[model samples]
Target: MKVLISGASVAGPVLAHWLHRYGFEPTIVERTPELRHGLGGHAVDLFSSAAEVTRWMGCWDAIDAARTRIDSMTMERFGRRPVEVDLSRMYAGISSSHVEILRGELTRILYDASRDTAEYIFGDSIASLSDDGSGVDVTFDSGTQRRFDLVIGADGLHSNVRRLAFGPEEPLRRWLGGYLAVFSMPDIFDVGNHTLAHLSVDKLVGIYGVHQTGQTRSGFLFRTPHELRYDYRDKDEQKALLVKEFSNYGWRVPQLLEHLESAEDFYFDSIAQITLDTWSKGRIGLVGDAGYCPGPAVGGGTSLAVMTAYVLARELAAARSDLASGLKSYERIIRPLVDQSRRIGPKLMGTIIPGSPLALRLMPFAAATLAKLPTAMQRFIWSQNAVGKTLSSVNLVQPQVSQSVA
Candidate 1:
């Protein structure tokens, strides 16, 4: 089968990997000019099943070696006598299995592993997709056109494929009333080879020294009741907001924002969730953040992508000639897990970044509950967050070989 997968991030390449394994020829299209090796923002982690997929993809050992040099995190109040909470007890609320790495780094790894076998179209995307019962004709932004047996929108929350195929993104988007910004800076803090400090003033400002990379990762997240008047795509306005919001704030914030102007890359976005009533329309389907991202707060974004991709590919190969049934069944099998994960995402974000003073007063209590070092720790540690959260999933099932032809 010939397939077209959009976005080079976690989901698209992952889908390509599994599709290749399943004997389907997959073509991956990405908007960026290259495999996005750098990060848009902060570090991310994979837990449980997602980590398993990393191992299957043959990149786990390297990921482990270059994992975020963060030994632990310190959450501070930033007053003259800062109140500090050790994060050793607080890292759980997400998942037990953890593979902390930059999102871009992970993407590049997946891309490299699959690029030789998979057809990759960089610096482009689909302008439109027209399906006529059999296959879809895809028109690219670069004026190139092609046809494919199937197409998947692994794009993201603002997936153009989703918009073009499923009839716009309005019905599927949920604004979670917050925004996050992540940027890089020089190693000026002498963080000493670990994720050093986390400062919270009703919000979160944190930094980590990415060991061996010779760079530091810094980010801040906060709540916004209504959308602010800022260019959602303009880097200057995004950086300016970070500076405006944190300009007068305390505890290394000024220093953190200082790198904004000179930073080569910056990641900024509204904290939102993508909830599709159904992830498929005819021969088209959706995966990862394009289908059911639990928002960045859930920290399962990457895992969801890999697992969704693996499951989708497996379902396809298993059904043989039954493409529509295969797609629907894949959705049914994955929905329960996806819904459960989504239910947990916002609650997790809220727990990390409280909305009001009443909520802020309860942080210590919540922190105590999260520090239990078991399931309690796992659930509570990942509670309320500011911006995007980094989480991923993996497919645990083996695909059945299809005997019939498409």
Candidate 2:
């Protein structure tokens, strides 16, 4: 069987890897010119099962070597003193096996692991897709046309393939009443090995510098009840909107905005979640953010991406000639976890960036209290949380190939 996948970031590569291992041919088309490396993005966490999946794919050692090494997090409220929270101890409460790595590093690792086995077509995108019972006929932006047994969209939130396969995103999207912007800049503040965050009612500005990389990543997030009107593809307009929203903010926001002018990899997006009725339609399917994204840059999105791809490939291998059965099984096994993970962002929104002064004042107090809890008690508390249940629930049995489809 031949499978064509869109977006080569996290889920696409993992799907390609497992499909190849299970005796299927997979090709990936990525819109970006090449794999992103060293270009800064926020850090992502992989729970126990997701981290195990990386080791299963043979990328854990490389990922571990490239992991971000922040020792602590400092939270500051403009008029108040800063409160320091120990990250190492806090993470222990969630899971003893949680792994933290930058988004770019994880993408690079996944790409490297799959490049040898999968054919990657960069610098182009799927222009159109038509599934006529037997297979999906794909047309690329470069005017190339091809047919594959199945098509998967592992693209991020604004998935081109999803738009083509499932119609518009607005209906499937649930905006979390917030927007997030992230960009890299020089470590001017010299916040060496420490993560710094300034919070206010409805606003948060965070900066963290990696000593090994000699670069800092700054992120801004603020809440808005209604959607802002703008072209998603317009970089200049996006930056301008960010400037307009954050121009008068305190902390190092002024400098952060100044650096945004020249930042090569500036990214801005609404903190939204994608919930679909079904992840597959006929021979076409959606994976990762394209299908069931809880919330971008928060919760277990990266972990969910890895887990979903693994489940999808395993189900496909098990149900060899039956695409419908395979897709149904894949969705059935993964949907519960997706539902639980989707709750993390909305539940923590007020805690992360309060909507009122009282909540803002209590944010640090909450963190300090959490940090002070005994490791075992913290672990128990976290295990009871939605994110914890979602993380602990993923247990993928390695798929055994019934026959060679290669």
Candidate 3:
């Protein structure tokens, strides 16, 4: 069977890797001109199950070696003294096997693992997908056309496959009442391997060092009463909006904004969830954030993406000749996990970006107190929460199908 996967970030590469291993011919079409390798992107967490998936792919060591060694954080509020939080201990509490690595690094590792096995086409994207009952005929923006037994959209929140297969993103998206912006800047603060954050009601500004590039990433997350109007693809408009939102806000924000104009990889998006009831329609299927994103930043999207892509591959392999059955089985297996994951983003948004003044004060205090707790005690506390339960809930079954080329 020939499987066509869209996007090459986390899920696309992971799915391609497993599909190839499971005896399917997988081809990945990535919009980026080249693979997004190195330590350029934002830091993302991989919990126990996601780590296990990486281990299964023999990429765990590489991922661990590339982890962001940010072990501690300093959180400052206007009136209160700065609070110190042991981030390493906090991550330990979240899962027994957890690593925080840059998104780009993780993608590079996954891509490397699958590149030799699966066919890769960069600087191109799916222009249209024609899914008949038996197969999918795909047309690329580069004017290339191909036919595949199956089509999977492993693209992120704004997925081209999802839009082409289902509908426009606006109706299917649920805004989590906030916006997130991130940009790379010089290491002006000179804080190495330590995160610095300024918190206030309805907003947060953070700067963390990227050791590989000798640069820092500044992130701004702020809540809006309603969705803001701007082109999703317009960086200048997005930067201007970010500046307008934080203009009066004092701290290191002014300095952060100074680098915004020149920042090449500036990213801006609403912290929203994709609320699609069904991930599949005919021969085309959706995986990861393409179908159901809990929310960016606050949600454990990286882990969710990794685990789901792996499950999709396993289920598809198991289905063998009955590919539709495989897609349904994949959906059924992940539905419970997906439903639970949806609850995390809203709760985390409330905690991370305080909605009120009291929350602003209490949030940092709670984090500091939690960091001070014993590792075991912290683990117990996290295990009782929605996030921990969700992270540990991924239970993958071994593929029943034989490993033979299709």
Which has the greatest TM-score?
A: 3
Best by lDDT: 3
Candidate 2 lDDT over 1-406, as tens digits, reads 9999999888999999999988889999998897776645677888788788888888889988887888699999988999989888888888877778888888888989999999999999999999998898999999999999999999989999899989999999998888888888899999888899999999999999866668888988888767898888899999999998999996789888889989988889888899898999999999999998888766578999999998999888878878777989999999888889889989877677789999999889788789889999998888898977987887776555443752
Per-residue lDDT of model 3, residues 219-249, tens digit only: 8999999899899899999999999999999
If the candidates were sorted by their lDDT against the true structure, best first, what order would they fall in?
3, 2, 1
Error of 3 at 279 (Å): 0.7
Candidate 1 root-mean-square deviation in Å: 3.7
- List the global CA lDDT of all models: 0.74, 0.87, 0.91
Candidate 1 regions with alpha-carbon error over 4 angstroms: 38-40, 80-96, 196-202, 361-369, 372-395, 398-406
Give per-residue CA lDDT, model 1, range 187-244, as digits (tens): 8987755665443534777677766567788877787667676666799888888787
TM-score for each prediction? 0.89, 0.97, 0.98
Candidate 2: residue 28 Cα off by (Å): 0.3
TM-score of 2: 0.97
Of the two candidates 2 and 3, the one with more favorable lDDT, higher being better, is 3
Which residue pairs in candidate 3 collide?
A: none
Higher-scoring candidate on TM-score, 2 or 3:
3
